[model samples]
Target: MADALVSIQILPRTPNGESVIPYVDRAIEIIQASGVRYVVGPLETTMEGDFSELLEIVKAMNDEMIRLGAPSVLSQVKISYNPTDGASIDRLIAKYRT
Candidate 1:
């Protein structure tokens, strides 16, 4: 069994007209800081690690964003379980199924 890969896409609408780059940067920073050996989004961040840990890492990142006063932020998070030794696009395919 392989660890689950979680992908979180943040769509933040800042009333202060804040730049989205910083938001994205902050998100990446938080995610990376979680100690999950995974890649970030918009460029297909391929990560490998524990499933539950990844979930916690992602949730924590979102919580941080909300705590930063972006509670109204819109996010699209996706989780996929890729075999440790197999080619899988199940996540991508699953996206359409929904």
Candidate 2:
């Protein structure tokens, strides 16, 4: 069970004022490599996993953005943690998914 749910929308500032599509693509690539249950919305991407792991992923996303030529990044993050029963991406959306 996932101990937390993390949703993030990263806005990486391009050094050359180029389109950020490629940078955003790299961020999503990091998420894909994490192998977590994730949903990519138009504005944000939500993932379910351990808090530490998710946080690490966030760092990796930021690092990758910098390596990809982003001068800075602004991330909007939301977290839901339930240590007892744990939060689930599927369970939370099952009703709507049906």
Candidate 3:
């Protein structure tokens, strides 16, 4: 079982004041490449995994934004950690799904 659920929204200040969609897309790509279970929502992306690993993913996403030419990055993160019993996205949201 996963030990944490983390939701992150990254805001990158573009180098030339361009659209941030592409940057956001790249961040999601990093999440996908990490092989963690995740959901991309309208405003944020949430992932389920070990608490430390998920936090590392968030750092990687922010670093990628800078590498992609953002002057700086801001990441808003929410975490639900249950080290003993574990946390799961499916278990939390299943009731809302059809």
Instruction: Kindly indicate the candidate among 2 and 3 with the higher TM-score.
Output: 3
Residue-level lDDT tens digits of model 2 in 8-95: 9999999989998888888999999999988999999999999999999999999999898888999999999998999998889899
| TM-score-better candidate, 1 vs 3 | 3
Arrange candidates by TM-score, descending: 3, 2, 1
Q: What tens digits encode model 3's per-residue C-alpha lDDT throughout 1-98?
A: 89999999999999999999999999999999999999999999999999999999999999899889999998999999999999999899899999
For candidate 1, write residues 30-80 as lDDT tens digits: 767766566555743444456777667666666767777675677776777
Q: What is the Å distance of residue 84 in model 2 from its true position?
A: 0.6
TM-score of each: 0.67, 0.94, 0.97
Per-candidate local distance difference test = 0.64, 0.93, 0.95
In model 1, state the lDDT of residue 28.
Answer: 81
Error at 49, model 2, angstroms: 0.7
List clash counts for every candidate, in order. Answer: 0, 0, 0
Q: Record all residue pairs in model 1 with backbone atoms less than 3 Å apart, i.e. clashing.
A: none
Model 3 poorest 10 in a row by lDDT: 59-68
